[model samples]
Target chain A: MSMFPIIMWILMVVVAFVIYIPVAIKINKTGLKRLGATAHIFTCDPDKDPIK
Target chain B: MSIYLGVFIGYFAIIIISSIVGAKKVETMGDFTTGGNSMGLILGVGTSVATWLSVASVMGVPGNIYSRGVCAITGWIAGWFGGTALMPLIAYKIRRPAVPTRTFPEFIHARYDADKDVSPLQIVAAVIELAGYFVFSFIQVQGFGIVLNRITGLPFVTCCWLFMIILVFTCFGGFQSVARTDTVNAILILIGVIAGAITVVNVAGGMGAIVENFATTTAPAVTGGNPIPAGSLTSTWGVFGASAIMSTFLSNSLGASVAPHWVARFMAPKNAKTGALQMFWVVIFLIPIFICIVIIGMGGKALMPSLPEGVTSDYMFPQLIINYLNPVLGSLALVAICAAAVSTANSMLLHCSTSLIYDIVRNIKFSGGKKATVEDDAKTTKVLRITILVLGVLAVIGAIQQWSFLADGFTYVYGAFGSVFFAMVWLGLYVKKMNRPAAWVSLIVGFILYFYCVTQGAPFGLPTFIVSGGCSVISAIIVMLVTKAPPVECYEAYFSDDPSEATVAAMHRIRRDDV
Candidate 1:
């Protein structure tokens, strides 16, 4: 009921986003070239892959 | 009552159909274990969020908040967010390897054992995973049974067995089935929690009223116990002291970051970027779900004030639904709990079976041997299915006992995992100088300290995981300094941005040619 916990929760969410989003973006940009075709074993086929 | 039953039946039918569809695509061990390492962002995010929002998060967290106060937010939610925040680095490193290991233990072998033999380190990791996930699976079954028993008026044991059937059906189809069903479960959980939160806010009049009631109410957490002091629920640490709150946060967050199931999840993504992105998205999405849970917990306090005599706080969520909400909405909320139970239970069950079959049994049987033949893959897949069934029965037996508080179960197991693997996984992936002796010593030191903390009590009442994890890092650093560095080949797959052709070939040789 005190706003402290809510404030703390929001702070944590912000901290997580700040830490994760950049790393994710960097990985997305560089990851495919780094790993190349060898790692891409499964084709992204909806019928074959578990999730559509 | 009939509406609840119909909704439950419909939920189970949907889950079964999804499993059947997922099972059709499983032609090799890779499909069973890692969803053929082809998960797109949506599926990856779905499974990760669903698995993360275990019954502990849905039921235990609210119950903890209902009983203790907002400290549950710091102890569980914040720590979990921190853990997820740290996961992109892990995902990047883990998925970077050209030939990824299917299981966590296999990754250990591939990283630490230059010879790629079934080393003691791999066996120890598998054993820990087996023990940890077995406990995790038990907790899920216990939570599921508690909810279903409350809803159906069936005997508790009957509800547990019912959950076991669902768990086995979900897990028997392996990672593919688990991931597919998990996506559906994730959606249901989101809707259910949002609806429950909205209903709670409405019943309590408004957010302001709920907050005022929660702050001023002196309701005892358990009936006939001492009333909670007024304003304590709104205090900085809530009812729990700083030490207890910090311990809970550290144990849940740090331990979960390197948890084997999460590591394996990183492997399932289509690429390194997807793995990292999925976790980022999962963290974003869980923000709303956790906020709703907090609202539900606080609002329940405003409405109920205190629970009935002899009833634990774990019953708070279901009791609220039964007492306040309409049948249709209540049924949906109950089904969400079921979804949480099934989504998490299947992942843990898969980890248990895979750790047993692929990590321990096969690693030992085929030590110093060639890569797995097509026939070996077929045989291992069959054995993994059998292990899931057997373990499901064992978990049902364990659940019948109702060992401890629902969320406390995770704290203990996560402590053990974080203590041992926090150094082993994180340092092993990044620190090329870390040697076999360092790995063995850190594991031993961490496990001993963890055991001691659990048995004798941790110093200053800190969580066992914090003490043990600290010791693990210190000992690992000291040992790494004194011991010789591991062979270049051992760490190259994880550390190198672009590993040499020879190193890639070696990595390929270390893993089973499952596809």
Candidate 2:
């Protein structure tokens, strides 16, 4: 009944899409490379090639 | 009655089948504890979302809204969303290490005190996890009993005992079993909550009617209670006022982000990307589920002006199903509550047992100069199963007593977790100079302050977490500034993208099973 709950709920959805999705995408793209360079675990994406 | 029993048996069969399948995979300690750290995206999202829903989200949120009005959204829903949104960052860092830590305390041990066989810090971390997850498991069991009692017309104590069977069966097979069943539970929960919401909306005579009832109805939440103030249910602050709402928001959002179970979820995924992506998808998936939950809660208030004498608002969702919905739909909704309870209970029980066996008992054994091997891992896995059974019994006992409002029980533990682990986990990951002394001081300060505030009341009517968490962060920073930098091995696995061979070896030594 209060517009407040509805408004806040929408804001939550917006935060998830705008913030979480991009961060996840960035991590997926570059996280392994960053780790491999320093940790030397894998040069390529482990998701694509099984962890060996 | 027959329809309810038939659907319930069918649901149990599916869950038991999944558990049996999951049991086949538990060949080693790693497999049991972290699903061999190989969970794919769908399973990852399913388990995470299922665990996130819990009984609190399904039952307590609606109950809170029914009693407190729309303000319940500020703390539980919005705060949880905010917490989940931040998990990708934590997940990225946690899953990045080459040889990932199997448990959250193991990560803490590797990050802060890798040089030692078993640091006091590891023991302390494990203790906190043990206590937290034990209470968490108890809450889930209590939730399950409440719903089952309503459905079957069983005594409350009997209902609590009935849940232990499901809890043990789901948890005995370990993480993989829990994950598999959780996926099933998540799908059911989605369908059940949505169906219930649609019915609630319809029964309440459309959204406009519901809103009008909420805004204008002079109904008390309980029989003989004072009538609700006009427009209070429609106000932004509602009856809870701003301070309570803000307090709830802080504890739920900030506390949940670093909760041990969530941290372990990051470790269960195969890689950093999967870990991060799983959470992203979980956030998206939960949006609709939570929206429907809001409708169910607010709509319940609209339909039932006040509950009968001595009835708690915690019964709102179940009562709605029984009185308003037909048998088939009602059974489905009740099963969904079962799913929510089982999914979370199994996960929490797993965490509880692992913290006891892997973190505390094995840590002590290994520290005493016993090296870990594959055989030892098998032995440990057996011990973990036994621990689950033992803890399940204890939780059943605790759950027999209706402790508090289901959601409020979570807030207390979340407040403790947020205060104690917030600074230690966040700073330990990002801050290179975060040494053992800082970590120790921060944890103690946070724990003491949180409990003190809880018992003596927080200053300025602020949430206990804000006061305790603030002090903890300040203390950690101050100590870190003065203390010597942590050893290279302690910091490298988390901070250095390319840790040296020695650092890698040290990390491997931290979890000899990985080696």
Candidate 3:
């Protein structure tokens, strides 16, 4: 692979990993809200979300 | 005219369909504003990539490539890369403390509790931000006109009017519609780019032939002969050392670190991790499109080997498309150009309306408390819609003003804001100490400095972006440090180890609303 490709890939992975942890803790603690009825990915109903 | 209209209508139909799909259930303020933040990784990444791949992506950028060679292009990618890289650091990791704000300046206000007396100051900063987006949107109007006339042989004014009407409808659907529209537009752009690249290279014989022709042609003593021919970026840094090269890199990082549309992407993402994932996707998908454009650029260089009189080197792509490329694919590329112009301009329009509605109209009187009364919230939404209408009208006026001067008027006016924002955005975010006094100082100083640089022959043939970026960053950082003001809780989050993990947990905990 070219230098640019290698650089962009490593940058993407490392940065994604770096940003992953704190967000996990925040979501785990307070829970989260689904975007809407169609929100397929991440939605913790406010009523049932942890602590609340 | 009919062919041009056919290409335009096809492109417009795809985007409008997506917008209408997204706008179906957007009933609330949040939904209206952020598409309820539910975009998938592909859509998010595609749209962001597409947004970056504006007229600049094809015509503006590769022109820089052909003229400066590979190194100059890489020099630019360094800054563009900086803007992308900083997303997780500046925004994703440090978002919670900022989640409540509506606009970019709101993030500024939330970050620093500057004196309440300086409300006008914040509005001035916003106006400064609008300057770039406005220039950008108007340029897209010209871009649409150029492609329409060039490809299908339509009247320029007719093309400009259609471009304006399409933008107003695309924007009227708000963020949700805009997102979906951008996704389709991005896809169309990618398809066109790939096809155009393939067709051009094949039609021109082959890559080796293209490069050889470029090297052998016209002006002697140019890169292998021609001045603006297909050489590389060996000269600009030919005499300058490693430090000079690094300075170019830092300037882009600094400049892109603060673009309004980029930061606005922060609010547009589904969640923190999704945002990060989206950034990765953008990088992955975008490389090919850029490579394709550069290939076409090389093909153009190979074909003309030199521009005709009264035409700049940038016209190479358009000239080639009109003369070469299979008719069907060339027509599709023309349509994709429209998509590129519309996608970028629509984002600018979205931000302009948001700024007007949230910052200007939302406040009746902030004499006491920072937040407004419930009644204040009631009318803000309608006001935003009205602002959208007014902005649409103004954009149409700007589009109509595309007289003999063509793009020069728009570029000069709009480029002003990009300089200012790129200068101060980071300090305003990470360096909490930058207060109202410093913010104002950096803004004014950066604006004048940028104008001066652009006006005064742009110095080293380098873009005004570098000078303006350096001055803005320096002014913003220096003032913040002098005052020793750090935004409350700013340091803790910015320096934290893992930011998106919290959202990942929320991702797991989420329940389908069924609403």
The CAPRI category of model 1 is acceptable
True contacts kept of 2: 0.47
For each candidate, the DockQ is 0.31, 0.32, 0.11
Best by lDDT: 2
Q: For residues B2-119, what per-residue lDDT tens digits would candidate 1 score against the true structure?
A: 9999999999999999999889889989899999888787888899999998989999999988888888888888888878888878987898887888889888888888565567
What's the i-RMS for candidate 3 in angstroms?
Answer: 6.4
TM-score of chain B of each: 0.98, 0.98, 0.82
Question: Which regions in candidate 3 have their CA more than 4 angstroms from the true location?
Answer: A1-52, B1-7, B66-72, B114-118, B219-252, B364-379, B399-419, B422-424, B457-478, B481-515
Point out the higher-scoring one by lDDT: 1 or 3.
1
| Residue-wise C-alpha lDDT for candidate 3, range B1-515, written one tens digit per residue | 45545776677777777777867756655566665555556667767877876776666555554544444344445445555666645445334432334467654543443334235654765675565566667777777777776765678677777788888778877777778788888888888888788887898899888666644444422234335332333333322234444444444544555566666676666555455556655655676777787678667666655556655444556667777876678777776777888888888887887666665544324434334444554456567767766776676667667532222333344345556665456665555465666767767776887778765745675556557666676777777677765533323333333435442322111110111
Candidate 2 runs further than 4 Å off: A25-52
Task: Please list the residue runs of candidate 1 whose C-alpha ends up more than 4 Å from where it truly belongs after superposition.
Answer: A25-31, A34-52
Output the chain A TM-score of model 1: 0.47
Error of 2 at B393 (Å): 0.7
In terms of lDDT, the poorest run of 10 residues in model 1 chain B is B506-515
Estimate, for each residue in B175-248, the C-alpha lDDT of model 2 and write its tens digit.
99999999999999998998899999988999888877878877899989999888888788888777778778
